[model samples]
Target: MKFSCVAAVALASAACGSGDGAHADPDLGVESSDTGALLAHADPEASGSCQLPDGPRTVHQMKGPLEDLQGDCVPTWTQEELNAGFTRIRDERMITLPENPGFERRIPWLAADNGCEERAQAASYYLTNWDYTTPYYARVLVKPNKRLILKTDNEPGGSVRWTHHVAPVVRVDGRLMILDPAVEPEKPLPIEEWLPRFSVAGEVDVALCRDHAIGDGCFAAAPVAPSPPQIGDKAAGLHLRLTAEWGVQEILGRDPHRVLGDCPPWVECEAEPTPDENRPPTIRHFRTDRLESEVFFPIYVIGDNFVEGVTTVRVTGNGVDEIALIDSSTMRSILLASWYDPGEYQVTAANGAHVSQPVVMKISEF
Candidate 1:
């Protein structure tokens, strides 16, 4: 019921804990002293202490609360210990596409473009399970029209932008150090250095949520939630509570390798590096579903090198042939399945003069 919301301007340091014994009262609407704003509507479903059982977790359950509120429950660990823990988690980054044959263990780094929330939640579970320390999350919520641009080698153009970002935080040598491997792969970054990376000319609101649910609570507690006009969408909020097991399994409920889609809001399912437009479109995967109405159902084709209006999709075979260009992204495209007869068909994507190799799709009679 207790969390800290710090309104930060130009990355100035702000205290991150409640000392006044303030707790959110559903009826009266508790106002966070830090933000001086009434607490956002609490999720009626959120209840009980935000703590979990000690040791490794597997089942999904409400986490129990931490008992160390005297110091805001942030761990006081040595620099060496902090760095070691950071490295241990950082090493979990996947070196290749998660689908690659040899891909191994923790953290989907390749899905880094817009999966910050999932990544952070997964990290928190690991930190707790490894016996490193139970950690709090540092959430940076940006204002309208601003972006948290992070330079990275993971995506094309050597950078990625975010509406907001959340990472696990630990107190090292009295300083709040961030454990975001996606941003600073080598070491922990102080909050000062970490905050400014989002925007140098703009101000952002920061909050320290005790758990995943509280992170969403922080966003709800904010004054104005920004929607980037340029992106034509709102950033997804974080809702990761690591009281169960290893972060990935807890969030995914299965092996990371077996899961498909469930992508973070920043990117769509089967998103990959933008392919060279000069080349033929590549079809990485395709997904289809049945709808009740079945009028103009969509066929989602995930791939690379797709031109918005110019690229075309062709599905042929089994007494039906269809081709159309509906909507497209560099990594994803939507083609109208239009209640095609149930049968196997060969599908190919084309951009300009180049065409992709044929892939198979089985459409069902709706």
Candidate 2:
């Protein structure tokens, strides 16, 4: 589905920041080519076209001759578009994973006991038949009866691993189909022969398969845990909550690098300001400072009398480099920072620069 252009721009702005006065790293992981390495494996001779009944669609028919399936397919959205889309998907689905005891963590096919080959074949068939565009993440919905169906990238011989990679599938007529980018990378196998080698631990029935959704958009929503008051100290608490959301995205293999080609590797953090409320309340001693190290330059906050009851501090840009709480009177950094206690603390950059805003946490005593 299409997202609001304004919202997309806001999200992108939050992720990349203004880059004004921001130090750019020359040797960062950003690649010259915009296309992902994974997509480079598409077979030149595969005998299928992306022309589905809908508009200009790309379809990979599993069990087809490679030569017959060769065609050029371009992604509709740019890297920025995909990044914003991924962030939205993560925020929406962050709370779906099961948190209680005895919960299954791994994807159904990725389990140890299941046959890897059979699962691979089924994944291949599903991918060959579907259309996949970049800037999209796949959400695998496994049902109870062993039926495995997906909503993204229908190409013949394509396989889905727990890593969240889906390959191309080419079907030659009805007899033989091949999946590209196999684990071996050298050999493409027939679907029927490959299916038995993979195991089917769980099944998924598609409750919803909306087109162009960021992730699978198939599985039913899972329960979410309530946000905790304080997880740890200022830094730890923020990191914990962000990490939980990142972990869920990782489980689905929705890394920014994979979904959005050429995007920087970023650790997700909470965005504090809203469209209506753009800036935090100003205090007298509040200051904005930049911390620089051999690796990165990060923004931080510093202030006195900042702690208040259940105050929500919003942070944007890249992930935190390091955080330290300090005593205001002593002017010395405190080793222990606790969210439960009210105290004056200083937040400094790992590279030895004072943060602009010193976040204050105040909990009500009722």
Candidate 3:
């Protein structure tokens, strides 16, 4: 019943706890708070103190409410201590999230960033290094019998088939609040009701990773959550990725504008690099001594720089045959069949980049 929204942005400062008398209602005066707007629709299902024994630790334990949560999985550290990972919990919610001073801070959640690792790390570094100190949590829950990534246009994608989604949850009072700081603004909801938005298209593999930051005692070998080695998570990495890509402007400037960014609204500012064309191969000589055969025959092609791999020999003059590479290191020979129209065929080779000069191949009905 006590649903509140974050009005102001969370301060990137040290952890400041709320005392026993710190209990206060949501800042209803927030007219256009991004988080406040989303929290308005919050429908809490379950309430009361946590029943489970091991978790939902006190706010004092978690430092502050959960932040920096992601829906996808990206490896941050290998299985070692040097590269530490956050502890994660699946399909569960923490009961006691502290209302630290930084709780009210609102972080802008941006759209997709193409699996870039460096930008991801810089964000995490900023969050951890900054003054804002909140004990971020990782809650990884896999939605079973839900739609996962499906294949599209010869490329495998998970978002297309993603009917259900997973995220991290922080316990406030006695209820759990979902912190999906990647796509949507931070909105707190119960697990039962929260599970519906992601309609089960199929089964999905989801993980909630928390960032211990750096030198916080968490390592790759042993993470907080009982999950895989989380790389770039929403908890810290995502928050930062969004910031570096776009949010940083907001952190320093008043108007958080995206001239061109990864998410929607801002179109891609830069164009993708076009691949350079390969140099055409120089055909020194072509053995035009073979007649049409029923099966297949070899055409010896002597040339320079006939790509050892992925180089195909194409024949196109009177007729054409599907070029298949037999052995293309020193001597580039191709297997030619007799299915083409009987005439003078020009044989050429290509390595996906450059095309080789034409060689004469005379074929007759033998």
Best by TM-score: 1
Give the TM-score of each candidate.
Answer: 0.44, 0.21, 0.25
Q: Candidate 2: where is the Cα deviation over 4 Å?
A: 1-137, 144-210, 214-360, 364-366
In model 1, the clashing pairs are 50-64, 51-63, 51-64, 51-65, 52-64, 57-244, 57-245
CA lDDT for candidate 3: 0.31
Q: How would the candidate models be sorted by lDDT, starting from the highest?
A: 1, 3, 2
lDDT of each: 0.48, 0.24, 0.31
Using lDDT as the yardstick, the better of models 1 and 3 is 1
The per-candidate count of clashes, in order, stands at 7, 65, 33
Model 2, 133-180: lDDT tens digits are: 221112122332333322222111133333122222223332332332
Q: Estimate candidate 2's alpha-carbon lDDT, on a 0 to 1 scale.
A: 0.24
lDDT of 3 by residue, 269-324 (tens): 45433222365555655432221122123344545545455566776775456564
Best by lDDT: 1
Error of 3 at 120 (Å): 10
Model 2, residue 65: distance off in Å is 23
lDDT score, residue 105, model 3?
21
Give residue 79's error in model 2 in angstroms.
19
